[model samples]
Target: MTAAQARTGDKNCRVVQWATGNIGLRSLRAIIEHPKLSLAGLYVYSDAKAGCDAGELCGLPPVGVRATRSIDDILALKADCVLYMPQTIDVDDLCSLLESGSNVVTTRTEFHHPARLDRAVRERIEAACRRGGTSLHSTGSSPGFITEAMPLVLLSLQRRLDVLRIHEYADCSSRDSPEMIFNIMGFGQAPNPQAEAGRAWYLREEFGPSLRVIAEAVGLSFDSVESSGQVALARKRTTIAAGVVEAGTVAAMRTTVSGMRNGKPLMSFTANWFVSYDIDADWKLRGDGWQVEVEGDCPLDMHLHFTVPEARKAATTPGYTAHRAINAVRYVCAAAPGIRTSVELPQIVTDLSAQA
Candidate 1:
């Protein structure tokens, strides 16, 4: 543990839930229910959510924590940490929070690897951390913790290490975001190599740095990183919770990013996200949940599966993403001031008891 973590001791960590979106709502609930944490403030971007009780926004009884649309109010609150969960990352706003001496735990993809951030932005974050003496940590579902952090933990038992592979097969039919499903994911678009290449570039830049973190943690030097993607066309026109899926349009996508050493792949991350089960029935929903495969002297393969009610299926992804960060608040608060990753933090375990 770093000096920051040691200084935190056993006090109840006060937290502000910033933004109450899908993941934010889950985070609000988690912070309220966590044994070692307290929900001190709530931040909301939507006018509709403002002035509402945090618990009510999360479908629970009022907890006396009212949501506010004002960032200034959040900044003024006496809190130890903020669970930043905005849809789009606003670096300036984040830096402001850090500068106010509040440690941060976010599910933002861009912050997963601070080194991957633009030079200017990276330096700004570091400066803020130094000025405020606070830390920033990021984690999420697939690209965040499942693929990178979890695999690294499992690899600790290995007597020898050669290659690491992580896979995620998600059925996103129940997701609530229509724009994300249809527009951003190209769910109803024709296969275009140029567009696919653009997506591959995104995957590479988004996840490549994370793979580098893993490589460095395991003492491997990677020579190159490559990204590729394939799309599965819809078998037939279908309608799901998100939107319509036209036949011949993209129904499923498989994106892979690999880190290579000495001409062989050292680490690979693959995500198979789909809106329906018809696109590639054989491969769709194949894994129990997330899978990590390692090839070494003590070869190992592991799967993580969760059973949730059908009504809550759409929330599983965001819920896990929120918990990954929420559960890390204790460690992040105690770590040295600066951007930190799951690889640097201690193992995060969930504690649901009322007493710390």
Candidate 2:
């Protein structure tokens, strides 16, 4: 083995995946199959999943790693790293995990910035990592990597800076998220009293974290960001292979920011899934006498639609996002270890096809 490989081997790093849901399962499948990574443990909150074979539930053959519900078991196994999904909202759980001396990577937006966290909790995680010689990384498919890092990368091509705009349009209804999430994004059923209570929409909270990332990437931050959403009802109902979906209802919402050089937005815009689907989510750039248009499907095989008319780009775009995240992992891992917001992290190159 090369010197670098030898060092990495000495660590004997093993990963513990913290969840087994959709995103978790996908991440597990990807990480487990990687040559350099191995499953140390699978931690689930549900008793039903406990003691199950981790790989089988994740749609893979057994890898000799069984699911366990005990955090102590995971720590006892001496896992070098933990890949955690964003499902756990319990601050206490976070504190305990960080204190366990295991490095962590998560998709949690709440941990995007240490400033946004409780001072005590932040100090605990930071102190734990410092004492244990580990790190904590938090990112998402969007805010965590793509929209933030992609813009920073594009700036390398520019001679002068005037304005930067990053756009993300997702047909979230296309995903199999929970009903509360669907309803908040104006999907699924109509307005009901119970639904209203569950209406913590995903757009701003989910997408806003990326904006913060972008600002930090370009050495800018916004103090005041203005956001608003509108519900568009379809003129007709439609159904995909998944199920029937209303065509029109809360069709879209736009979020934009314009203000300070730090957190202020020179300009910004957001289009809800419904609105963007009805319209177009192609990326556009106009600067340095250069105009670039970007739009495509995600890169996942299931979402790929080469034969389809509109969605050929859908499958391609997400793959772009996913690839960017994977590529960023090396940089994030190497950077100063702690729970860092997007801005706190160093600028990462976004070309997934690039060789390390």
lDDT of 2 by residue, 219-258 (tens): 6666755554434444456553334556544334344333
lDDT of 1 by residue, 1-356 (tens): 64344334578899999988778888898888876788999999888889999999998889999999888998898589999988888888899999998999988778776776899999999999999899998787767777677878778888687898988777777776789888878887888888789988988887888888877887876899999988888889989788789998888888888999889888898888887778744664563378889999889888877677668676665677888888788888888999998788877765655554
In model 2, which runs have C-alpha deviations exceeding 4 angstroms? 1-12, 172-184, 188-202, 239-248, 253-264, 267-271, 275-334, 341-356
Candidate 1 residue runs with Cα over 4 Å from true position:
1-10, 237-239, 243-246, 280-288
Minimal lDDT window, size 10, model 2: 285-294
Which candidate wins on TM-score?
1
Q: After superposition, how far is residue 281 of candidate 2 from its true place, in Å?
A: 14
Please list the C-alpha lDDT of all candidates, in the order they appear: 0.83, 0.54
Give candidate 2's TM-score: 0.72
